[model samples]
Target: MQKNSFLTLSVAVLLVFSLQVSAQDAQPEAGVTPSSPFHIFDRFGDWARLNLLTFNQVRKAEIKAEIAEERLAELKAVVLEGASEDVVNQAESLSTAVAEEVETDVSRLDEEGRNIADLTDKFNQLSLRHQAVIEEILEKAPAESREALTKALEVSKRGLEKAGEVVLKQVEKGNLEKERAEKIAERTIEQLKKQVENRSEALKKITEELGEAPPELQERFNAKLQLLEKELVNVESNEQFKDLRERIREDLKATVEDAREFRKMHNVEDEDSDDILESISEDGAKVVERVEKILSKAKEKVAELERSVAQAQTNGKEIPARVSSLLDAAQKHLTEAVAAFEAKNFGRAYGQATSALQNAKNGNKFFEDEDSDEERDENVLEKIEEANKKIAEAERKVEEFKSKGGEVPAEALRVIEEAKKQVVLAKEALAKSDFALALRHAEFAKKVVEKIGALLERARKAVNSGTSNTLRVETKTEVKNEEVERPANTASSAARQPQVRQVKITAEGFLPRELEVKKGDTVVWTNATAKPSWPASAMLPTHDVYPEKGGCIASAFDACKGLAEGESFKVQFNPIGAWKYHD
Candidate 1:
């Protein structure tokens, strides 16, 4: 009975150990899902080993393959032990797809690798041809070209060495996917081809460069050579003790070949311009793309400015008049840029867009540089005092004109009344401590007073037996430089204003040579002469008279660039003046 109990206990222990082993085997690894259609391996290292071993020829491939097979075996055991029938069916189809993808990627990588190897061989052959050519031509090449040619050869050699090192590192890492490896191979081949082509061109350039040995060209070549030599030395020193010596040996063979090819094509000129035309077309598209990007950036800046202005508004801070005007100008320029771009005038479009960007930047800078609200309020107070003083002085001048029994122009009285109204508005804004508004109103009031004082002086001059016709003054309210179509009814609109009047230029010089119109009226000058007529501001010694103070061809003051018979040039009488213009 004692012997039987010992055997039964031993059997029980063995059965428990087996059950524990089965339970552990049934459990899935971390990241392993028994029911899922797709598999995500527990570790990238395992996945990489499995994929890399198939393509790599190193001894490590055998070891990594064994480890990957064991891991897959464990995964299969777990799936078979725990996965339901439905999961097994789904995984079957998914596994097939994944297998097909792997096969395709592997095939693609093999094909690309073959292509790369072939190109590398071809390049090597070309390099040998070039080496022979370089040796043959170097003795005959001009002294001026030797330095440049030698430097180009060194640069090409160093670039090849560096590229080879990079390729070796990739091979050792062994983690790149099949697709990725294929792409890399293609890219390497492309780079090699371009490098070879460049070397050929460099060699050809020696001949051309020798034909024109200007001092500047020699200087530039010497500078570039120095830089290349320095870089080559640096590369040689850094890679000296590394295992890359053997690799460099192999690379030098190719380099020498490349150097030879460079000298071979010394006299061969380009035979076709297809590549040149293609390059130009590509460059043009790139330029247009860059311009469009600039336009987009400029627009964003303007929008940012607008947002800043809106924020200031929310805080009950008024935008300064000048700031507002600048913002308007920025917007105007941006619109013009868009129009110019649409018309395919990229040069003008870029200029206008850049201007808009700068203007918006300036506006933001102005806002940031502004004084604090309290300081601004104090400044506004001082401005009000100055404006009031100027208004008083202007009123005194007006009274003096009346005492002299001079005819006070109706426009003068109207401006004085407007000045008073602006002053009232300024005082109201000052009471509310709205400094920006107060300053704007106060400055405008001061401008009106100054304008009225000038009118009063002109009236005084009229009293000295000068013409008393209505004074037509053209003042610079805004700088208008944008090219836009004018409203067709501009003359009719000017006529509708009560304070505006008209003047005409007929077949004879000026209809009433010295006739005047009210301020803000339209002066329509028709070229009624049979010959082309130029109505321009008079330069003192030559023409002797001008319609306005700032009148010049640029300002469109008497601007008729020889209008043909029946053509007309219209000038808006904005400035207050007793002025004259002639053909």
Candidate 2:
């Protein structure tokens, strides 16, 4: 009986509403048309009539919602039209108010014993979609408009959060269960994730394109790259997102592609018409002849190293197994080079010979000194101080590079860290009263710092329109750092300091075999070895002592991991003395 009464009430209310709408549409002064009337009645008329006592309240709510929505649309258009800050802020405020009003009305309708939960959900969906459109616009906005666009995005995010809260409150009020509320919240989270993914893709693409950027654009390019890397690193390090790796695959791929492009542009060589190091050397024939000479020198050096190895064995010295392995590799490559030469493949022979020579020289460093001299070097403290100063200068330059928004190379950072480690080791040696080892470590650290400084200087130059087109390959030639004289009181004298000097190492030994430099000048040693090579002071086998009392055995320097082929180390000289070093 009650159900029949409810159906009759619903029918009567709909008939009356339809009559009123038609009467208004027929009168031109009423400014109401049948098609222009509130469509709210089409969906909610039955529900409103079920409880007719609140009919007036429902009608007012509907009218208010219609006004709010219209206002919202107008404001949205103003923002989309690229309005001024004041207008944009007004639009955002209006949108927020309208969203809040619609939500409040839905809650009121539910409170009035009306069944309108589904209506509330529909409105929320529309609100979310509106925000999506705003977000899309922000993504395409120009850099100059980023601040405004970002502000708009934040507003939308906050609005969505408010909507989620409303849903949760409804759950508390028994209008929704906890499970349903959770599902709605999950929907919002998914939307947020998609937005973040889109942003990540855009950033990665920017970083990739930055690979071929001109020098003038490097600062801006690096700024974007730095921002992307920092954000991606944060995402990667988040424990909560660990399981979402698959979702972040696109972001990760972007990072990888950026790195690959950088290496491709900087390190990886393209094949030339003539295969024998055409990009590295001028004349193929000259390169081949040089390699042949290097191979012959390696043969003699290896013989000397073998004899030392035998003596060390006889004397029961503690020999690192690495020495023997390097020897074997050296001999193998030399044999290969000989075979290539015999077959008239000069290019192949040259490459093989170069590799063999590097290996042989590296193997020889271990056997340089069979016993350490018990000498106390008085200059250890001086060398340590000099090294610290150089490292400080290098660190300052690195900071400057970062401040200018330069893309600091990972290798450059690694080199600085290595220098710091060497400093620690040097201090430990000093504490042990091993002056020779201390001095050597201090020297190595200084060299590494000089290299880092040189690299950062080059980066700074790039920001000022310098180009870095050539690969930093290890060469078997000594290039002195270019020094220019300036007035002693010039404020920018440091900026005009000489470029870093370079020293190349192969199987024969350090190219030039001797280096001369003024105090504070730096020299870089590049290893073109096929095998790993450790560079230390002229003390090995029994490195407990030095040949001269002035040399500290505790100050020894060696790259903990012997340098690989094409790798390099740099050192700054500050001591005024004749320092003798060998391979």
In angstroms, give how far residue 25 of model 2 lies from its true place.
24
Clashes per candidate (backbone, < 3 Å): 11, 19
Error of 1 at 91 (Å): 76
**In candidate 2, residue 212 scores what lDDT?**
25
- Candidate 1 has its poorest 10 consecutive residues by lDDT at 268-277
**Predicted model with the maximum TM-score:** 2
Best by lDDT: 2
Model 2, range 152-190, lDDT digits (tens) per residue?
544444344345434534655677655555445445444
Q: What are the Cα lDDT values of the candidates? A: 0.47, 0.50
Q: Give candidate 1 misplaced runs (Cα > 4 Å).
A: 1-366, 414-441, 451-458, 464-514, 517-583
lDDT tens digits, residue span 1-583, model 1: 9999996775555444333432342222223433543343323334444454245433233323233223333333334334444443333333223323332333343344422332222222222222223333332334334443344333333333232333323343443333343333333433444445544444344323222222222333332222222222222222221333233434433443443343333322211112212222333234455556668877988988888888999999877776687689899979988986785545345546656876687677646646875687788878878888887887787788778555567657656665666677677766654455677777776766677766777655643422345544332221137555353224434554634333455643466545556445676667666767667654442223233433443345756456788887776654444454544
- What TM-score does structure 2 among the candidates reach? 0.26
